[model samples]
Target: MGRKLMSTLAVLSLILQTISAMNVICYHGTWSRYRSGNGSLKISDIDASLCTHYIYAFVGLDSSTYEVVSLDSWLDISLNGFADAVALKESNSNLKVLLAIGGWNEGSAKYSTMASNSTNRATFISSVISMLQTYSFDGFDVDWEYPARRDSTNSEDKENFALLLKELREAFDTYGFILTAAVSATPSSADISYDVPSLSTYLDSINLMEYDYFGAWDDVTGHNAPLNGQSVYFGTTYAEYNLHSSVYGWIERGADPSKLALGIPLYGRTFTLSNSSSNGVGAAVSGAGPAGPYTASAGFLGIQRDFGRVR
Candidate 1:
C-alpha cells in the first residue's frame, strides 16, 4: 500500500509540474481605456483560473521609431499595481507578462522607416530592451497592423517588414528575451509580410490574430471565428482552422510548432446583412437598439469594462 501510494504521488507531482510550467498565455488590452476611474480590470465571464497565463495589456509602438511606448500613463499603474497584484493574489509565480508593441490603428509605416536605417534600428532595439528590463517584462508582442501589402495604400510596406523582424529578433536573442509577432490572417497577408522559416528561430511564438474574420469591412456578413465552411479555409475558425491549422501551416513552411500561440477574442462581431430572409428569420441587428436597450462601442470594450479583475 505504501509503495502504491508513493508511485501515485510521483505521477501527480509530475502532472502538476508540467501544468505550472506551460507557456500558453492569453492577452488583454490596456485597462484605463475600458475600466472605470477606480482602475479596475476584469476578465468577463471567462474563468481567469483556466487561462494558463495572462498578458495584462498592450503597450503601443512608438510612431517616430517603432519602439514601444506607454500610453495614457497606465504603464506605471500596471507595473506598480496590477502585475504585482496578479503575482501576489494568484500565487502564480510562473506567470509571464508581455508588453505588446504596435496595434491595428498604429500602422506599419513607421516600422518601415525605422527598419530602413541601421542607426535607427540600433536605437529602436535599445529602447525596446530598456522598456522590457525596466518593467521586467518576460516578452514582447509586435502587432504591426499589416505588412507586405495592405489596403492598396500600404502595399509597398511589405518587404521592409521582414527586414525589421530579422533585426528585432537578433537583438532579442542577444538579450535572451522572448520575441513574438502578431501575423495577418489571410495566406496572402502571411506570404507577403512574414518570412516564416527564417523568422521562426528568432521568435519565441507567432500569435495569429484569428479574429476579425468578418466585419463591416466586407459588404456581406460573417462570423468572427467560424468552425467550418469556406471561411475555415481562410483561417476563420478557432476550433476548426484555428491555432492547430495555423501552427501546422507554419510548420509546413518550416516554423517550429512549440513557438506558436493562438489569439482568441473575448468579444463577438455583429453585422447587418442586406437580405434579411437569407440571414435567417429575425436577423436584423443594430449597433444601437430600441429604448432602454444597449449601445455598441467599437472593439471589445465589454471584456475590459467588466472582465479583468485579478480575483
Candidate 2:
C-alpha cells in the first residue's frame, strides 16, 4: 500500500507542479468548527474556485515520535476533514490543498528539536511525506511561528531551519510536491529567524503573515494589517509593521517577489477604548473588546455584532 501510494502521489505531484501560477492562497483553520457557532464550517462550505491554493491550517508534530499528529480528532479522522478538503479539487481542478503544520501557541519546541539534528530531521521528513500520502495532500506548508527565539527554541534553530527546509525540498522534489512556509512579518523576527536566501531557494512560496501588527497586546490600537506603514501610533511609528516593510524587507534580504504571497486578515482586531473621545487610528486601548456572538473572539465577527451599539 505504501509503494502504491507513493507511485500514485508522484504522478499527481507532477501534474500539479506543471499548473500555472497561484494567484491566491486561502488558509482554512479546522478549528473554525468550534468557533463558527451554528455547528461547524465544513470543507463543503469553501468556494474552492476563489483561490488557486487552499491550506488546511495545522497538523502537529509529535514531540517524542517526530511524526505527524492530528490536532483535532473529529476534524482529522472522524469527519475525514483532509479527504473532504482534497475533494474541493473536484469543483476547481486547479485548486491545490496543502496541510500546514505549527501555529501560534502551538509551541516551537518540537520543531526546533526536530530541525536541530540530522536524524530527527530525516525522520520528520519521512513522517511528513507519509502524512501527505495518507491524506492525499498536494504539498506541505511549514508554519513554525518564529524560530531561533527564546522560549521553546534555541539559537541554533536559524541554521537548522535552513537545513530542514533543504532536506524537505529534496524529498518534495522527488515527488514533485510543492513546498511553502508561513513566516513572520516583523522585521526583527524575520531577521533573527530566517536565512531568507537559502530558504527561498527551497520554497515554492513564502506566505507573509502581515497581520497582527497591533492587537490586545498593544496599549495603543492600530490597523491589524496595514498595506503601507504610513500610520503613526502613540509616538511609536507603526511603519515597520505594515505589509510594504515586510515584503520589502524579505526581498531586500534575498526573497523573491514572485514567490511571495502577502497574507490579508479576514477578521479585524478590536480594542477597548481607553478614552472614548480619543478613538481613532492611534487611540489608547485598555484591552480587547468583547467576544463575538459566533466566532467568540474580539475580532471582525465580534465587532460586526456590536456595530450599532456605539460603545
Candidate 3:
C-alpha cells in the first residue's frame, strides 16, 4: 500500500470576460461560520474589491408563511452576518450588496406554491422589499432551485414564474433594488425551469451555475468543471457536459448573453477509487473521497461564485 487510491480534484473554471467590463458577483455562504479556524470565512473576510456585487446566500422560505425569513438567526441577526456583509459597501462604494433566498436545500415545491398564487407572490414580494429595506441592501436574488420543474406536465409554474418576476421587477424598480436570479447550467433544467425572455427582461443579471459537470454520482472519476469534453471515447454526453455548452445553452435558450453571469465553484469534487492502480479519468470509484478539512461534506467540497457582462 505505497500509494493512495482516492483522488481529489478542484473544479477549475475561468471567468470569460467577453465584454470590456464585467460583473463579478460574489456569493458568500454564511454557514462557513460553523467551520472552525482559517476554514471559516466570515463576512468580514470578504474582499469587496475583488467583487462587483457581494451576495449573502440562503435566507429561508417559511413553508407555511410563504414569506422571507433568516434560516440562522444567530449568524444572520445576532452575529450581524447580513449587516456586516452590507457594511462592505464602505470599502467599495460600487459594490452592490444583495440578499439571496432559496437554494438547493429549500427545494422547488414550496416555491412553486408561493409563485403559483398571485396573492402569495405579492406577499413574498412585500416581504422581500421589507427585508431589503431593513438590511439596506442594494438588491435581491431569487435562487429557487427551479420553477416549472416541480410539475412538468403542467406549465403553470412556467407561466406563473414569469409573472412573479415581472411583479418583482416592477416592485424592485420603484425601490431601485437590483434584481437577479441564480439559474441552472444544465440545458434540460433550463428548458423546464425558465421562461427565458422574462428572465432576460426582468433580471439585472443571471447567475449561471456552470460547474458540477461531474461528481461522486458517476461511476467514473471526472473533472468537476471541464472546459471541454475529454474525448470521443467518453461519448456525446461527455462532449456536451463541459462549460461551453452550459454558457451557450442558456444563451441559445433566449437568455440575454449580456445578463448571464458565469458561476465557478470555489471548491472541488472528491472521489474514492475502487482500485488504487486504476486512478485515472475513467477509473472506477467506490464512493466520495474524504471530506475536506473545512467543508466536512463527504461527497462534495464547496463554494460558488460568478462573473457577468458589464454594460
Candidate 4:
C-alpha cells in the first residue's frame, strides 16, 4: 500500500511539472483594432488567461536611425498599446507582453543592413533597449522575415543574423528580460536563413510560423495548417509543409524542442476553387478567396460567415 501511494504521488508530480513548462504564446495584431466597420479589438478584449505571452505584432525600424518606429501611432502610442497589454498582468501576473519587431512585407533591407554592420548593430541594440524601457515591454520578439533571401536581403545576412541575435540576447540578459523570435517554417528557408542551433542558444523561444503553407499565391489548393503530412497528394512532396514536419525539422536542425513553440493561425487562408467538384487537397485554384467583411482579407471571421451559410 505504501509503495502504491508513493508511485501515485510521483506520477502526479511529473504531470504537474509538464503542465507548468508548457507555454501558450499568442500574437495580437494591432491592426485588428481597425477592422472595417466594427470597432477595433482592444487589449481589454484579450482573455489574459489564454496566453502566457502576448506579442504585439509589428513595430518597424527607422531606416536612418535604426530606432524602433511605430507604424500606427494611434494604436501604439496614443492608445498606449504596450501599457494596455501589460495591464493584463494586473489580473494574470504571469502574462508577459512583448513588442514584436518587423513582419511580412515589412522588407528585410533595413534588418540586413543593421545586422551586417557592427556600428548599425550597436545602434539597433541600444534602440531596442530604450524602447523596451520606455514602453515597459517585458521582452522583445524579432520578426525579420528572412535573412539571406533574394528579396531585399544579402548572403552575408546569414552570419550577421546570428551576430545580431547574440548581441540582442546579451542586452536582454543584462535586463533579465525574455528574447524570442518568429522564424520561417519552410525547411529550405529555415536552413538558409538561420543558424538554428546558435539561435536556440540565445533565444528563450522560437515561434515557428507553420501556417501560410498554401494560400492565394499557390496555383493548387492545400491545407493552410495541416497537422500531419499524410493527407498530401501523391507526386507532390511539397505538401510535407505541415506543423509536425516543420517542428521536427527545426528540432532536427538543432533548435531545442522545449524552446520551440508551434504557431497556430487564428485566421484561415482562403483559396478560390477553379473546379468546385475538385475541391480537395491539391485542387486547382484560380485566385484568392474574397476578402473578409471586417478584416478586409481572407481572415477566419470571413471563413466563419461561409461556414454559417453552408450550415
> Candidate order by lDDT, highest to lowest?
3, 2, 4, 1
Give the per-residue Cα lDDT of candidate 2 at 100: 87
Candidate 1 vs candidate 3: the lDDT winner is 3
Instruction: Put down candidate 4 lDDT per residue, 1-311, tens digits, no spaces.
Output: 11011110011100000112457887776676655444246678778787788888778898898878887888788888778877888878987888988876466888888888899899998988998988888999998877886455568887899899999998889997889988888667778789999899989888777666766677877776688884538355664577787878888889888888776654556677899999887888898777556555542233333344332
> What's the CA RMSD of model 1 in angstroms?
11.6
Per-residue lDDT for 1-311 in model 3, tens only? 00101112232211221211656888776776777665677878777788888888779788788899998899899999888988999999998898989766666788888888888898999999999999899999898766766432345777777889999999989989999887777677777778888899999888876666777777888887777767853776567667787778888888888888877666667789899899888789998887666656666565432111111
Error of 3 at 220 (Å): 1.6
What are the lDDT scores of the predictions, listed in order?
A: 0.52, 0.73, 0.74, 0.72
lDDT score, candidate 2, position 69: 86
Model 2 Cα lDDT, one tens digit per residue, 116-234: 88998888999999989988899999988658764555788888899999999999999888899888876767788899998789999888776667777677778776777754444
**Residue 83, candidate 1: alpha-carbon lDDT:** 52
Root-mean-square deviation of candidate 4: 10.4
In model 1, which residue pairs have backbone atoms overlapping below 3 Å? 41-308, 41-309, 42-307, 42-308, 42-309, 43-307, 43-308, 44-307, 148-158
Candidate 4 TM-score over all chains jointly: 0.88
lDDT per residue (tens digit) for residues 100-195 in model 1: 666655555776666666777678788988988876777677776665433323454555566667887887787777777767644445666777
Q: Report, for all candidates in order, the number of backbone clashes.
A: 9, 0, 0, 1
Stronger candidate by TM-score (1 vs 4): 4
In model 3, which runs have C-alpha deviations exceeding 4 angstroms? 1-20, 150-155, 302-311
> Residue 29 in candidate 3 has what lDDT?
68
Shift of residue 282 alpha carbon in model 3, Å:
2.4
